[model samples]
Target: MPASLGLLRALVLLLLLLAFLDPKWPREGRVVYLLDFSPSAREGVFALAERLPREGIFLAFAERVERLPAPTARRLDLGERTDIQRAFLEALKLSPDRVVLVSDGLFPPLAPPFPLDALYVPPKPHVALSLLPPPYPLYGETVGVGVVLEAPRPAEARLRVEGPGGVWTRTLRVEGRKVLPYAFPLEGEAEVWAVAEGPWGRSEARLRLAPADRARALVLGDPALARYLEAQGFQVEEGPFRLPLEADLVAVGLGVLDLPEGAPEALRAYLHRGGGLLFTATPRGLFFGGWDRVLPEDLPLKPLGREGAALVLVLDVSGSMEGEKLSLAVAAALELIGTATPEDRVGVVVFASGHRVLFPPRPMTLQAKKEAQSLLLSLRAGGGTVLGGALREAVDLLKGVPGGRKGILVLTDGQVADDREALLALAAGAGAEVSAIALGQDADAPLLEALARRGGGRFYRAATPKELPRLFLREGQEVFRGGALEGRFPVEKAPHPLTEPFAFPPLEVLLPARAEPWAEVLLRSGERALLALGERGEGRVAALATDLSRSWRDFAGAAPFLGGLARYLAGAGRALALYAYPEGEGVRVVVLGRLEAPRLLAGGKETPLLPAGPGRFEGVARGEGVLLDGKRRIPLSLPLPGEWTPRDGEATLRAMAEATGGRLLSPEEAGRGVRRPLPLRPYLLLAALLLFLLERFLEARVPRGTLREGAPG
Candidate 1:
């Protein structure tokens, strides 16, 4: 008992002394700080590292992680590209309390749910020129050059493009930013360069062009369609669907055809490797076929006969829209006049403080067109934006027009001071679809959107006066062409082989379009579907509302849109597309399409593929090869347009931060933490006092003999 009492006394004294001294200790766990060491991030990384917590912090560079001090003061040595998700996953494995990321905000799109601190480092003043070279250089075929510039906004830049044909240069007046597209006709195997000169400096890149291989396609229905493919330079093969041969694509027309044994397997293999298939069949033949499981039903058909249309153009001449806004409005009016067929009827209404009928509704005869053009040119801008008044006038004019199809096109800055609900009711009562355009940033976007919603028509936005005419032209074309009476399917978002490149916000089309149970919506404008895809037997099929020619012009000749559509039609089958590049000691194979099966073919031998995420596979290759899945072999080819281009990715990073409830910080404000006070001292002092009292009480209760014996051995 005596010994136990003494030990307890000593422990109490020690606790008291330690509590008074109050020594500081490091926090519970270390913080991991990840740094991006890409070429653009080097200079800023050193400065960023100094801002991190001084103690219990580990440093990690791209692809490699190690303890601090060992990695200190080293050059920003890392890979050319950065994989943020991979690095983050590695950091998570370390089990740190928090992870800090220092980068220039150029990360690929990441899904939701993660905890991270993103410290943005503004890139040094520099311009980067990224080019999209054509996948194949076909002689006499024109290919587009896509250029993206990353530099300080509002700076002058000169783009000089040189190819085999000659040199082309243009001085571009860039807004905060711009995407410049150009076209060049291919001649032969040649070296091409796209050089950009700006305030930051000069940046140039070289690309080598080679001739394209002639792709083979089989047409199984209309002989005319086969002839059309031949005209487009495809090596055409025509026969029944049972033709025993290999081809890159297949097109079918309306008819009942017999399927051959193993043909379905062959087609399924083709679609899996990113081949395309198209069908132009009658509605009856499309639904009631042997392809029930794969083919889409309830497909919309074009109208049997063309119908005339009546269109009313409502223009806003408000005082706020004086200079360029008025000019663009007049130009749009003229374009609408140009689109009117001889049988179409047109009218015009102009409104500022009040609305006036510039031209009453009438058949678009040669004389009527001349008078409407004259009235539009004579108009001038003034007063407030009375949108309701103008819409009422247009509805009145269109009420009695003779046609099943009728529409009202309103072009304005969208600023208004009128009864909003009344205007919408007028549009709905007239039974004419009302489509609206917001001319500039200051326009009342919400009101215009609501107007179009109630009227059951499309809504469009023009960021600048220059874009106004195009929007008007598209609107005019729709009205003059009879308002999509031949219904088109608007795209709804779904995962498919065709939607890989569609990253923009969903766009909505006015007309209501739908898909069958087997079909999936791939693209949308807002809420409306724009494109849909499905399968037929082993082949893929697609439907589009927008005319291909008009879409090309509107999208600045986007080749991928057409190519992706074709690939969807071809259907994704069981195969892999491998492109090998020499890396360090071995070769790296990139899975081009969604790698359905993991296998490769080289010199007629098959090998299993080891997956490295983001469509990469590491392998040892004896020579060039192709990707394979069972009997299907997808040949190695040049990268697609979707692969060659790099996205800026600023929006993606912001979204990730927002989704995780984290804050974004700049370099000046990164890595600093406010320490909370530790209250261990008071708790320690109180515990020691209690233990001393307990020892004293126990010693007092012990007998004298028992104390002498003390914990008997």
Candidate 2:
């Protein structure tokens, strides 16, 4: 009876201990934390992550979307852009039952593939500076500037402009997000600033202004093209591609490749010295193909043929190419033949299970053109595609052709049983290039590209039959002007400074489309953005949506716009030299020129700047600003905060929280309500002591001699 009582006491003690010490398994759902690693979102992300439970939480950097190591610091320095959508999609693949996201909500929100919780950091107050008109005004010209303020409530903003004359200040009332335009004559270099006092406190933005300079342009093409540059205040100099020492820009015309031996190297050196080059050539110009090494490494430009070529049109007439593909292919070939000059021989080869020479190599005489057109119209699609045989026939036809360059333009709608490597080797051996046109989305793109690369020719793709003609025209004729763009698209006001005076007649873009993260959309067509501008390294790039061809119909009045864009891109070579950016709580100055020590002049006092890095200096400025680099004065400005369009992300955060079945709270509220790690050591120790006391008490009460201690038989 005594032993039974002891056992009951022990059982009660174990139950109490179990209740006090709660245990969890590793397999339990983890709270995966996906945080933006962008510059402005880093601090807030880390702060929120630190306050959350550590055991069940996992850390993933949203920039690259990978788990941070155990020794990851509380916060890290972030500079590059973040792809939030890609990061979220990756996080969902981990199949975490719960997720937490933190960001400043500056970037666009993409639909989540899966549900998750989000905590948004409040946006910091700031102002934006925008140049409104006269995007490329002459020196000492007056231009209109727009100032935008983003604040929580009504506020008074102080505006100032400091230039060759002196400092000018004005006061204006603003609420929420407001834009106030101001006109200022830019005399040499200038600086503009706006300071606003709002509910979130004081916010400021500074902008450096420099009127466009009259460029000294060197022209290598027909002097007629020089008229365009001359209209843009350029002192045109006619010469070969042998870049002159005084030339600020070089414009090479089509078929101009005879450089004075080391000229390309000299041009490379010139680019490093802040000189710019513009090549105007057909998409197949030799400049784009062989001279790419002279251009910037990150330049998103395609290669072109380096010399005039005797082009053989190799066409696929397989059964698969019957419908629209065959029709487009025939039309594209005719267009290419029309573009060939009398000096360039044009030939045609059609293939199905076998190859047939539709037209032998010959100059495009009037009679020859008619004959080619009639032959193309009569052709019909049938049988299987043997690409290798067609390529071999085309290469053989170009072997004896009298031309400095030789290549074949192959148009195919589908893959075929052919030895691709053998075809490439044959083309190479015959000293011929092979360009490929992949029609329709199902066309073998990688295969075509490989053929082009191996044969040392350009590759083109037609997403639909409608694009086949344009693609052919782009590649066949001298259309791609050495990556130069010319279009008359009417520009509605855009966010980028490059498109400040964006106003053009309604027109369509004809070039291939490209999208880079760093690029800013400057113009749009309905919902499709047409003109995109960006800066890479130290050079500026402008990508247009349409092909800028004489066939664009609306390009008659676009000369001014095209010239302005060219000058803008050329001047961008110097834009990076005098740039100022916001760093932490101050403005950092980056100059390309040589200087011993740099100091910032603000509000009549000098603030010494320490060397931040190579060719960079850092200092704080409250109002209008200027920089003295011992040799000369450089205007300075802080980056406008609205550059990313930061906003209060409460709505998005709430939506995400509800989607994932999680609660929404501010940082302060989260800190107060979030579960803290429970310490079980004390509770466990207390339970043990209580159990021991109970055991002693029970033993004493059991009467030592009266208790029977025999074992059960």
Candidate with best TM-score: 1
Of the candidates shown, which would achieve the greatest lDDT relative to the real structure?
1
* Candidate 2 local lDDT, residue 223: 52
Scanning candidate 2 in windows of ten residues, the lowest lDDT window is: 298-307
Off by over 4 Å in 1: 2-36, 45-79, 83-102, 108-119, 134-141, 150-155, 173-191, 215-713
What TM-score does candidate 2 get on C-alpha atoms? 0.32
Tell me the TM-score of each prediction against the true structure.
Answer: 0.34, 0.32
lDDT of 1 by residue, 75-183 (tens): 6456655566677776777776556677666545565334666776655455566654543334434555555555533456788887765788978754433455556
Report every candidate's CA lDDT. 0.60, 0.60
lDDT of 2 by residue, 333-420 (tens): 7866765545567888999999999988897777898999999999999998788877877877877777676667888878757876
